[model samples]
Target chain A: MILTVTLNAALDITYHVPRLQPHTTHRVGEVVERPGGKGLNVARVLAALGHDTVATGLVGGRTGEALRAHLAAAAPGVVDALVPVGGETRRTIAVVDGESGDATMFNEPGPTVSAQEWAHFQDAYRELLIDAHVVALCGSLPPGLPVGSYAELVRTARSAGVHVLLDTSGEPLRRGIAARPDVIKPNAEELARLTGLTEPLRAAHEARRRGAYAVVASNGPQGLLAVTDEGTWRAAPPARFEGNPTGAGDAAVAGLLSALVEGLPWPERLARAAALSAATVLAPAAGEFDGAAYERLLPQIDTLP
Target chain B: MILTVTLNAALDITYHVPRLQPHTTHRVGEVVERPGGKGLNVARVLAALGHDTVATGLVGGRTGEALRAHLAAAAPGVVDALVPVGGETRRTIAVVDGESGDATMFNEPGPTVSAQEWAHFQDAYRELLIDAHVVALCGSLPPGLPVGSYAELVRTARSAGVHVLLDTSGEPLRRGIAARPDVIKPNAEELARLTGLTEPLRAAHEARRRGAYAVVASNGPQGLLAVTDEGTWRAAPPARFEGNPTGAGDAAVAGLLSALVEGLPWPERLARAAALSAATVLAPAAGEFDGAAYERLLPQIDTLP
Candidate 1:
């Protein structure tokens, strides 16, 4: 089973309105809600693609219950082993102005994790890691959690023989990479912050040398760039997608993790990851890919090494 | 006992932010949540002022649970006799940008009530009306509900010997007035829309002639105008209050209801309503009337007949 951890899971609400005028009233025409966070995003895709996935994270209060209910109904295959906490789960509102087709996001800070909650998460994670072939530690650390939280997760997963993948930014990513996760996936900006290099390939190489076995970096429309012991590769989709690109990154992580579990070659893995990500951009819900879109774009992907 | 019905109640979420910019993510500084809707807002103030207020309406799902929890914790004196439905309660977001001191509101459409749910609400409303001295039917009717829903509610309350006060707009208010609710409060725009008269006093008289026992019109900073069977009166606060006026109307309803139960004269009722409405503007939360501000402004109010 593949384990995905979202330390700061959210109840994502999308409000559709005709237009969004700042400091004015907007009567939303439609409201769509779902469970969200980087790890949950990845787990959702993996489950949709028929991967055996378990999603574990901190969840509390009524918002947490709503998130759990949504996840169950939306992604039935993904087992929820969430750790209970004291504080309420956070919510992210994306007000989509239908006229402009632009989204304005208001993010609520996730619940403060008490010391006891953190300890509970550690024990729960260790138990989950024992049955996992691969584990993906994803998203921001909630308040009251140390900056090295992901690093601790990575080290623990590795100690239990679970191949750990770290996908985050800032101190958590920096510290997690130092713990030598099997894989580290960063977008162009996050990669630059990690290695201080503007060029994707060069930055991925620097990132790999910093302790990760393989470094995969996303360059927006340019697609995936990777550096590993096996070889270096670049993968691009057939065409560009100009829709909501909110969860495309997480879809790429799911593709990479899924391919790794299946023992696919590096080039094939990149092609799959790139195709899934491009397909996700065409989907209405953030981080979800259309199956037909992915299948159609799979062979058309340009995989060069 | 004062019974207030919020047909379309909400979980009001207030987000305090440094600044509000379109199409950007805002990290909220603080979050204050309360159970809201016009009737709930009225019930809150009545309870604060030591009135035996019973609040009833439709609520369901996890969001509904959160609303109940908040109401229990914040307004313990206000009895929650709310009806349970199948759909989750809606939420309204008020983003207060600290820099400009302006609020941007995003109101979610409340749950769609099935016929069964509407019937349940009717049963609950009838039970509460039995012991009520006054009943307030407030706010808009949610979708899937007929436009004449409030008219039925008004007629039912009148038949039960409960004095009904209505505060709404558009087709709902127009139909509700035909049932002759004891009092109908409309702001300038609503009054104009109802009577098709640009003049407030003229429209108030026209509204009363159309079967309403009394017509109370709010003319923004000018305070309230009343045309009742007793007499016509104008009540103004000591001075203009330039602040959030989202729930000032609800506060006025609370004030009017409170004085009416005490058998106060029209002049005194109008004075209390105007003072409470003005004090609401000075308070942080929409419906909360500032005790100090209300006390300070009470003696200075200009009440004329």
Candidate 2:
């Protein structure tokens, strides 16, 4: 079973407005809500791909309840190992302009987890790690959690003999890479922030050098680049697709983790990751891939050495 | 006892952002949530002012639970007699720009009430009406509810010998007024839409002609105008106090109801209502009146004969 952890899971809301004008009241035409976070999104795809997955994190207040309810409805097969916290979980709003299809987002800073809550989560994560073949530590750490929380999670997963994929940015990534996780997935922007390199190849190489066993960098529509212990490979998309890009990186992470669990070669993993990432862009909303698109293009992605 | 009905209640959420830009994400600095709707706001102010009040409406799903929890925490004295429905209650978001103090609002159209849910609410309202002295039917009717629902509520309150005050807009206001509610409060623009008169005093008089025993119209900083069976009067604010005007009208409703329940004269009622309205503008956030501001301006408001 794969264990995905979202420290800052959110109740994602999308409000459809005719036009977005500043300093005016809007009558939203439609409202769509879903459970969201990088790890949750990854777990959603993983479950859809017929993988046994358990999602564990800190959930609290009414928003947390809503997130749990949605998770139950959206992915009934996936196990929910979420622990409780004191503060209300946060919500993120995406006000999508109906005319332009552009979205403006207002994201609430997630609840501050108490030190006690952090300890409780650690116990739960350690227990879940016992049965996990692979673990994915995803998203930013919420307030009150140590900056090296992801690093600690990586270490714990490693101690359990699980292949862990750490997907994050900034300080957490910098500290986590040092723990030598089995893999790390960073988009081009995050790669530059971490390795201070503009190029994906150099950034991934530099990231691997920092102790990551494997480094995968997603470069948007251009596709994915990977530097693994076996070899380095690149997978480029056949065409460009433009839509909501919010979940593309999470989809790539899902692809890489799925391939790792399947014991696929680096080239095959890179190809699937790139194609799935692009296919997610064509899906109607975030965190979902178009099966038809995925099937048609799955065989078209060409991996290069 | 005062019973305030908010058929289309919402979980009001305010997010403070440093600045707002289209198509960009904002990290909210603060998040404030409250149970809201015109009637709920009125109930809150009433409870704060030491009145016995009960808030009733339709609430369901996680948002509804949160709203009830907040109401319980904020006003323990106020009775929450809200009924349940099948759909999830809606949320309204106010994106407040920290630098400018300007807010952009996005309001969700509340849950669509099933026919069965509407019948269930009627039963609850009928039972509550027996113990109520005054009933305020407030805000928009949620979708799937009959447009004449407020009219029916006004008649029910009247049958129970309870004075009814109706505050709404458009067709709901039109149908509700024919029930001869003891009072009807409409803002300047809503009055213009309902009576086709841009002039405040003229609109108030015309609204009274439609069967409301009294008609009150809020005219922004200018204050309130009233046309009652006793006479026509205008209560002007002492001065303009600008802030979040979201709950000014609700505060005015609270003041008028407090005065009505006390059997105060029209002039005094208008003065208190106008003073409370201005005081609410001076108060931070919504549904609150600054006591000092209300005290300082109450005696100063000049009621024109």
Candidate 3:
């Protein structure tokens, strides 16, 4: 079982408009709503790829209810989310122009989680991690939560003999890496912010020295770079494609966690992660990956040091 | 008794931010949620002013539930909204910059009202208008409904011996006036759009000549103009004050309906409407009129031919 923790969940709403002109009225052509947040996105992709996953987070208000309902309707058996009370879940509105494929996003500041809500979430997470083979901490912390919240959670999961993966940015990532999670996934920008290094290889190495067993840095179309205890390796997809790249990082996290749970070798995990991420960019909507595309690209993905 | 109908009601969400920069993330300082839609706004102001009013509209999904909860919590015993199945009510996000008093509004396309939902709403509106002295058909029509939807509604209320006030725009206003509603309130822009006359007096006169008993055209800080069978007049507020002007038009409609329900003279009704509209602009948030400010301005409002 894979347990993914999304501390700040969101009700992601995508509105298809012909075009977006700021400060003007627009008539949306279509609206699609889904449950969102980094951890939830990774969990959803894993579930869609035939992995059993449980998503836990603090959810409140009507937006939270809508998020849970959307998740249930999307993947009933594979996805289970625990909702906590206090503030309404935040919402992210993406105004996508179907013709141009450009998107303008307006994100609402999600509800602030009270002290009691964080305690409740931690308790639920501890219980869920008991049976989990792999645990992933994803996304930003809600307000009122200590910056070291992810670090504390990672340490707890490790104590329970669970393989933990940390994927975040800024201070949380810096603090969580110090606790030495088994794996950390950071995009190039976040990697730079964390290690103060522009070169991908140097930054990955710096991250590994800080206690991460493996540091995977995604460089968009340039593919994935992993610095592990074994050695540094680069994996690239067989071809480049164009589509919505919003959730590609989450797809990579899902791929890595799924392979780790299945006991795949480091090289195989890196290849699979790159393949899944490339396939995700080909999907029409955000956070959705094409399983058939992943299958087609798997054998051709190139992993090189 | 006043009954207000909002065919496309909304969960109005206002996010207070210091300033708005396109494509950048902002941490909102405050968030306020209210039950909105022109008719709903009108009803809220009427209830605050001590009028007996009922607000009916088409509501669905979780957003609809939240709208009802907000109305119930804010102005208890004043809201009686009828819910219809099929589509969730829409949400309007107002990104307000407090310093500049400017708001960037993103209005969601409201729920598509199926034929069944429209039938249900019509039945509810008829029942609510039975004992009502004035029936206000306000705001835009939901998708899938004809442009003359408000016209049909106004005719229905008039047939039941209820004085109908139509407040909408474009085709709805153009057709609704032909139904000979007792009163029609269109802002300067809407009036120009309806009559193709940029001159306010000419627009109001043309609207009244087109079967409407009276035409009330609100001209923002310039105040209001009215052309009635009895006479034609313009009313200006004593002073111009700066605040959110989002719902001032709806507040004017509420003031007009309040005086009409009390059998006040047309000039008095027009004066109250202008005063309340300005008072609404003085309120910190949209859809609320400051009672003290309204009272202060009422006595000083000037009416001219």
Against the true structure, whose DockQ is highest?
A: 2
**Over the stretch B1-305, how does candidate 3's per-residue lDDT look in tens digits?**
88998889999988777766654556666778998889888988899989998999888888888888888887775767666768888888777776776666677888888887788888888888878999888999888788989888988998999999999988988999999999998889989988899998888888888989998888889898888989888999877777878789998999899999888998899999998999889987677888899999999999887
List, residue by residue over B20-69, the lDDT tens digit for candidate 1.
88888888767889898899899989999999999998887787888989
- The 10-residue segment with the lowest total lDDT in model 2 chain A: A237-246
Clashing pairs in 1: none
Off by over 4 Å in 1: none
What TM-score, to 2 decimals, does candidate 3 have?
0.96
Q: lDDT by residue for model 2 over A1-305, one digit each (tens)?
A: 98999999999999999999999999988988899988999898889888999999888988899899999999887799989999888899999998898989998889999888998899999999989989999998888889999999999999889999999999999999999999999888999999989988888889999999998888888888888888888898888887767788888888888887899888988887887787899898777898788778878897898
Give the alpha-carbon lDDT of every model: 0.91, 0.90, 0.86
Task: Give the per-residue lDDT of model 2 (tens digit) for B1-305.
Answer: 99999999999998989899999999888999999888999998899888999999999888899899999998887899999998888899988887788889999999999988998899999999988989999999898988899999999899989999999998999999998899999999999998899988888888888999999989999888898889988999877776767789999999999998999999999998998899898997577789999999999999998
Ranking by DockQ: 2, 1, 3
Interface RMSD of 1: 0.8
Candidate 3 per-residue lDDT over residues A1-305, each given as its tens digit: 99999888889988777765655666666778998999888888888878889988788888888888888888675567666687878888777766667676667778887777777788888888888999999998877789999999999999999999999999999999999999999999999989999998999999999989899999998899989888888999977788878899999999999998899988899999999998899987678898899999989899998
Can you list each candidate's DockQ? Answer: 0.84, 0.90, 0.51
- What is candidate 1's lDDT per residue for A1-305, written digit by digit as tens? 99999999999999999999988999988889999999999999999999999999999988899899999999999999999898989999999888888888899899999888999999999999888999999999888899999999989998899998899999899999999999999999999988899888888888888899999999888999888899999999877788778889999999999999999999999999999999999886676788999999999999998
- lDDT for model 1: 0.91
Q: After best superposition, candidate 3 residue B182: deviation in angstroms?
A: 0.4
